[model samples]
Target: MTPAGRATGAGRVFPPLPQHPDPQAPFATSWWGNAWIGALEGTSLDAGRLARGRAYAREGHVDTITVAPGRIVAYVHGSRPRPYRAEIRMRTLTPEDWDNFLDAVATEPAHIAALLDKDMPHALVDAAERAGVQLLPGPGDLVPSCTCPDHGRPCKHAAALTYQTARLLDADPFVLLLLRGGDEQALLDELAQRNAHQAAREQSATTPGATGESLPGTLARDALATDYRPPLPAPLPPPAHPGEPPLLPSLPGAPNPTSLEFLATDTANRAHAYLTTGTAPFPTADPWHDAVRLAASHPGLTGRRSFSRQFAELARSVDHTPTDLSRAAAAWRQGGEEGLSVLESPWDPPAGPFDRARGALITADLPRMTIHHNHLTNASGSLQLRYGRDGRWYPYRSEPGRDDWWPEGEADADPVGAVTGMIGS
Candidate 1:
């Protein structure tokens, strides 16, 4: 796709950009950076103001920027005696858009690799757009506001801030996610959630079942070109969710419509769950864990009634309490047995990880915390963490009026965020 401002039909420009004074490096060097600049120049009606803004940015008029969810703020100096507070606001993506974006990004492992290398590949952007996420700004996506006296859409100061922010976007793609309503760790946590079942799914796919059917594979080159699903105008599998069996008329002295609806909804949900993972929802090797897994899969009471009775019977046989089953089942729902281990077990970890985690917590400006053995607890003992064997921190809340800790939420790859997220919740 062409950058907004540079698109001249047939790839011809009436007048080309001037030669750069520095051939080795130029302002807005990255394609995304150039795209940002394109958005700015494409939408602005005053070319002279944009030129002045570029000059101001080059002359170091912009201050350090603080980027938040949907805004970037900085101080830009012009001919005026006092610096003006400049802001460039972009529309923050909604949760649905973010979900689609992350789904697209996760589909291609190379996309995350590209981000790690500080490169935003066009293919990743294309993938996101295909998923209905518009990553780069279009003509009106950027709304520049400034505290300056000038009445232009974007005064020179605001434009300066925009240019600097583009450089920032060029340097790190996470900055763009921030502008679009996602933070790095939050996005990572969510991506982790989506991938929580990924391994089990992959294993389930490759491992044959009772029938021992071989799972066939196809090359992309062959798959993309065939009509009979060989290379492929492939069959659309099944409908995304289970369709209702023929609408049944209720008979007297039989089940009511409400009961039938409940059964139908439960059946559809189970099928949807299966379709979602392409397998059962997170199976495990341990029988107890598998039982807990089954319980978690049935969500509402109507669906869970049978599982609840089974769990009660099993809990009695195992000499475990109902509360214990509830807690473990919650963990199983979050990710699987790994999540359960994070909750129920703790082992000694090397100090190296502890020290690194301590630094991150400090950076997050969390309440003062002290690490003890494999746990990190705040001074007041209200919030806490337990280091898992898997090198992730799991959040726990203090049992009110008691001296014990119980797991609260999913394990976080980021130690600081694990506890910080609890605070927000």
Candidate 2:
């Protein structure tokens, strides 16, 4: 069924939409109050984000739209996009014009209703059709539901959007044309022509060029013409980046399995081997399986988080009394796999606060984990590692409170030798 048309008074000025208050608000009335309402129908259906909605958007889920013929479609979010069988023939209006119309309505509701009951405009219908507003072809109510705290098909956010869009429709009326398909300027021009024709009929027998006005004369009066000027190009600034560990040299006291030149050379050799022999030089696990296993081993490293070089300071602060403890401390100062390996693997059940046999690596349940040559400690500290999915490696830390294993005295000791002895023991 066709909806009633809205009328615009000749010479009435259409005001702009309201300004948005918070720039960061996820959903704002102003943002959703745009002319292209149907474009938003399928945007909320991002599968990746919706799959992990709880951990991702915190609680908000998405809604889908139902498309139909010759009517503006309704959209709401939930498990899936559903159709609201009931049809609402709609029109859009600018917020400013809408407010003015509402004020006039409040002053005289009967007059507004009478005009709404009048014949609908062809321009509006054509524009609305072009905008892709259509009756959704479906059987049931299209309720948007989210797995988030909001249980209904449409949350407060979507509902607010719906109500606000409706209110915008009650104003300037051309916004409805904009919603239907045409831009604001286009609709306004059409309406302006209609007004001009009516005025011409009312004042018949007028000759052309009676006013002798031209477009350029009007353009001369425009604010843009008065303010027009070219801008100067600014100077380019030097690139600056954050403080990071030196990749090539590594750091003083850091682990170095081999020189970078050697490692790069080895990687190049491996690539050549793969290219020539058609065999993988390095053992590559399935990314998904590797990520799952890596996650299980650490259990805590879920998101894109990193750790800094605070462990170095902690190591420097420890005091040594006994000779064995002194040796462990010196080994720790050396900062590498050899130093940390001297610190015994932290047992699943640690013996003391400073267990001679248990360290961070042992407690973190690191299994068959390859320590990079640059890792600060192999046994007890954080590991800057990567997941299978991400492009780069990040830092992972052991759970706090349980501390034992690497001692100040064992820092300088041969941890690999100690581990070998343990294998024998």
Candidate 3:
């Protein structure tokens, strides 16, 4: 199969460049979950880094190799210790077994384990064990034996591969999982089977064995008939206590509650509202962190839009709603020229003082926002840019040697002038 974002080349798959370059601006330095690296230990795979390694593999880069159960084996180019190739161990599933496994996985969702039985390498090996799968060491698991007499962990070629894979996995998780034998659906299926036999046993015990008979199919069907589902009882009125006032009122001597205070209290009632709901859009740093933390906590979620949707749902309330730009910006870190692009796309020309007024056309005020730009370079040469704010024209151009962004000074100077400077310099 072709690597993501790339076309097939002579029947061989080549890796594609990143589709989205900038993840937008204000969100650049998001440190959402303290455990992005730490948490990998609890799962069979480092869904995050495995993703990056897959991208490296696509480009045909020698730095990284991805395998089953979301394992990413990276080699150091010339670190020191060299690794040896293990005996080749190949297992081809029989047509029947493969079909049964696929069918079983298709019936449910995740299926990483049943498809592969290797323990995850790296710090996440423990995580894989917890999830009940072992990511194994096989061909392509490590670099070929190194000639270096030093016996260091990895030589230069292996080290280079390791760095490259680490960078790749940092960018995409799907690629990592693909390298693993199963995808999310496959993993979930394996997990389901582990508990399934217990459920079947419970059902058998509940049935009577006298006369060697089983519950009649028709009677069993009737027991679960939707038409016979019990009707939901009407909501009960708040209970009344003997001699209690008909309705709870403001404390006798306390001042009456104001709408604003009531709204504020309402927001506080929900979980993580401060991080979730706010009238202001998420600024670059904190917003993305808040978002990734949520996604990392919940698997199978991806893309910048997913973060936007989750944040909206988590913070859905009036008081927590950002009523003004100031309130919105408050949710993010403060910096000057940096602050301007807090709620804007990085792909667009950086937001200047003048753009602030234009935000009113979309809404009375701009919510905190950030534009993400991912600059990718590989066999494929595609540019990916995503903007957060609604109205604005983003300008982009190519510069030799720079894939992620234009040089810092160039990004800020007049486009015409910047081009001239590049030519002169």
Q: Give the number of the best model, judged by TM-score.
A: 1
TM-score of each: 0.44, 0.24, 0.23
lDDT of 1 by residue, 1-425 (tens): 11111111111001112323442455787989888888888899999999888777777778656676666666575665335657777887776788788788876778877877888999999999999989999887888887666988788988888877777777788788777767676676666665645655676778777353556898888867756643658656766655432222347888654335335645676686787678975445576775566445433211211233444655565567655766676666555677777667667789998888888888878776788778888877778887877777888787544756656766788888788778777
lDDT of 3 by residue, 340-410 (tens): 35324344335552244234322532222233342212122222122223332222223434542322112
Model 2 Cα shift for residue 81 (angstroms): 19
Ranking by TM-score: 1, 2, 3
Please give me the total number of clashing residue pairs in predicted model 3.
79
Q: Which regions in candidate 3 have their CA more than 4 angstroms from the true location? A: 1-140, 144-161, 164-180, 206-420, 423-425
Model 2: C-alpha RMSD to truth? 21.3
Residue 319 CA error for candidate 1 (Å)? Answer: 76
TM value for model 2: 0.24
Better of 1 and 3 by TM-score: 1
Error of 2 at 201 (Å): 1.4
Q: What CA root-mean-square deviation does each model show from the true structure?
A: 22.6, 21.3, 23.4
Task: Identify the leading candidate in terms of lDDT.
Answer: 1
